[model samples]
Target: MGASRIKWHVVVFLAPAVLVYTAIMIFPLFNTLRLALYSEADQVRAFVGLENFRRLFGDPNWSGAFWNALGNNFWFFFIHMLVQNPIGIALAAILSHPRLRFAAFYRSAIFIPTILSFVIVGFAWKLILSPIWGIAPDMLDAIGLKSLFAPWLGKEEYALTTLALISVWQFVGIPMMLIYAALLSIPEEILEAAEVEGLTGMAAFWKIKLPLILPSIGIISILTFVGNFNAFDLIYAAQGALAGPNFATDILGTFMYRTFFGFQLQLGDPHMGSAIATAMFAIILLGVCVYLFAIQTRIRRYQF
Candidate 1:
């Protein structure tokens, strides 16, 4: 009787959260998936099955945009992986040092941008980088490097890379904090043993600390993947829905938005939009599965 009452209590506690999640997340997700399978003609919806997918993959007009956005998305993810994660790991290592002064202040200062709205970060960066009225050129000129100043966001070759770097600046604190916590959690006894073995300073970190924090690093990497794939707002705010400089900064999110909601002269096609969204979902799922099944397994093996 007591166990039955406890079970009832658990159910009662969980019911509201489960209901809310279903309403907000599960329902919309399944609805989008369903919408992707149908098409509208003369205000009448019809079951088109895989026709939308075929159109997305086979139609040159649709496929070109899709592939462009996808390739840019990959490049964006690559930049975060290449630049952001290493810098984050390095910052975490430096900040986690016992002798470091004002560590709390430094952590807070670095992390403040992460809490700022994407719109604010995007617009602020755009203004700072603007050649006509921006401070970036002035700052470079002050440092005797004015000749290197180009309108980075205005050029197709530099726009996506510039935006990727901006994103890295905004979110690098996350990986830093995660890695910092992981570093702090390492037992003192292990450090003492490592010190006895002459693993001090950089040697200690590379040999002793990094190995134990591999799991945290793996988690941060996967989080970066998911976050980068879902990225839209920053690009949208920075470059508008068109993702211009000839769509150089266009990613899956902006593409989906443009297709789903219609921008300027383009007519909204929810079915095709949902198809694009479904492709994004598939890509994210595949990346996550690979991480969970392959990379995570390897990390576990390395740890054991």
Candidate 2:
């Protein structure tokens, strides 16, 4: 009787959280998906069933922006994978060094950017890089590389990559701290034993430390994957809703916004917007599933 009562108490306590989550998150998510199958008719909603999705993907008027945004989104993910992860690992390794002075200061300095508002970082970088502001040009000229400096964010060839690098600079701290903590969790005796076995420096790191930290690296990789896919605020703040110059920096987030809210000249189409959102959700879900099933399974055997 007492055990049953205790179970009931646990259920009662947990019910609120579960209910709230179901209502706020899961419910809304599923509702939005359902809404994607609908279209507004004379301000009254009606089920259209895949018509919105077909139009988004098949209609030329909609397809160009959809494909463009999706392509940019992938490039954004690629930048984080290629640049962010390696740099973060290197920073973590440097931070883990025993002889390093002012370790706390370094960690705090590195992480401070991650704590700032996206609006601040985005606008600050915009001003610094703005050709009109001349900061980038002046800094480049000081280094005798002024000719190499261009209005990167304003150029179609470089806009997406520039925004990506800015994001990497701001957010690399997360992976750095995570990897650093993982490195610290490793037993000192393991390193000492490796040194005893004539493995030191690069070899010690590669052979001993690297293997042990692989799991943390894996975790960081997955987190980066999720974050890059969901990214929006930085690009939107810096580039505006249009992601100009002439949609040069357009990504899925900005694309979704444009579709949902409409810009100065374009009319908002909620049905198509919902379709785009559904597509983004599907892609993210697919990535997570692949990681969980394929990459995560491979990681577990190597973890111990």
Candidate 3:
């Protein structure tokens, strides 16, 4: 028999996607890395190695902002991880019940926020939460909880966490849907067997369905990490470029934007911006790598 020929058609089919990805993602990533390695002086760009990074970590002026923003970013992510994902899992569990009514309607309503523009969501929430001309205080008063009402967005102690909660409200549907899909994909036979074995209800879910959905949960975790780290639009729209009330809501994304674009009197520093971007990239990459290696590897995929 003659030797089999290589499949040229496969490469042809992939060429367009590859080219587009390279142009939009890979090229920009490498260019940013390259930019991070250089320093600009007197209209001259020079390769200065890790000086920008050193300044980011060592210099008090830069390090303070960098660390604060970074810490806020982590807190933002932690809220979503703790509050959002657990709520999503519970909601998904409830919605995925075979006997549930209006599942479609509920799903659509829950997911509606995810489709809304960040600008609309941010601005709308800002107005709704505003002390002046906002309905929140009135609604709370109606329920006899008026004292709980505060200008959450304006308070430094509450701003970041409140924004994080708002983000959670908008994005919880994502993890719910991912988990719901994973749950639905489980075979009827397995669930039936579990029921027969007296493992119905929450017990069945914890023993059987939960393990099966771990992969999807892991994927959602990584995605959440990436998304939170990359988040900017909502904060920018609601809090402005400063991420104020004393920069309490400042995150890596907004920090990078301010550094790159020069907010107020501060001059734009591309190298420093690139350094921040690189750091963000490294953090995300490290997270993905850890999830893939540590979590995914440990989760056993069952074939049914």
Q: lDDT per residue, candidate 2, 231-251, as tens digits?
A: 789988999999998887898
**On a 0 to 100 scale, what is the lDDT of residue 178 in model 1?**
98
lDDT of 1 at 290: 90
Model 3 C-alpha RMSD vs. true structure (Å) is 2.1
lDDT of 3 by residue, 1-304 (tens): 3358767887899999999999999999999999999999999999999989999999998999999999999999999999998999999999999989999999999999999988999999999999997599999999999999999999999999999999999999999999999989999999998988899988998999888999998999999999999999999999999999999999999999999999889999999999999999999999999998999889997776
Model 1 clash tally? 0
**Residue pairs in candidate 3 whose N, alpha carbon or C atoms collide under 3 angstroms:** none
What lDDT would each prediction earn against the true structure? 0.93, 0.88, 0.94
Among all candidates shown, the one with the greatest lDDT: 3
Candidate 2 clashes: the total is: 0
The C-alpha stretches of model 3 lying farther than 4 A from their native spots are 1-15
| Cα shift from native, residue 98, model 1 (Å) | 0.8
Pairs clashing within candidate 2: none
lDDT of 2 at 49: 98
Residue 91 miss distance in model 3 (angstroms): 1.3
Candidate 2 local distance difference test against the native: 0.88
Clashes found in each candidate (C-alpha, N, C closer than 3 A): 0, 0, 0
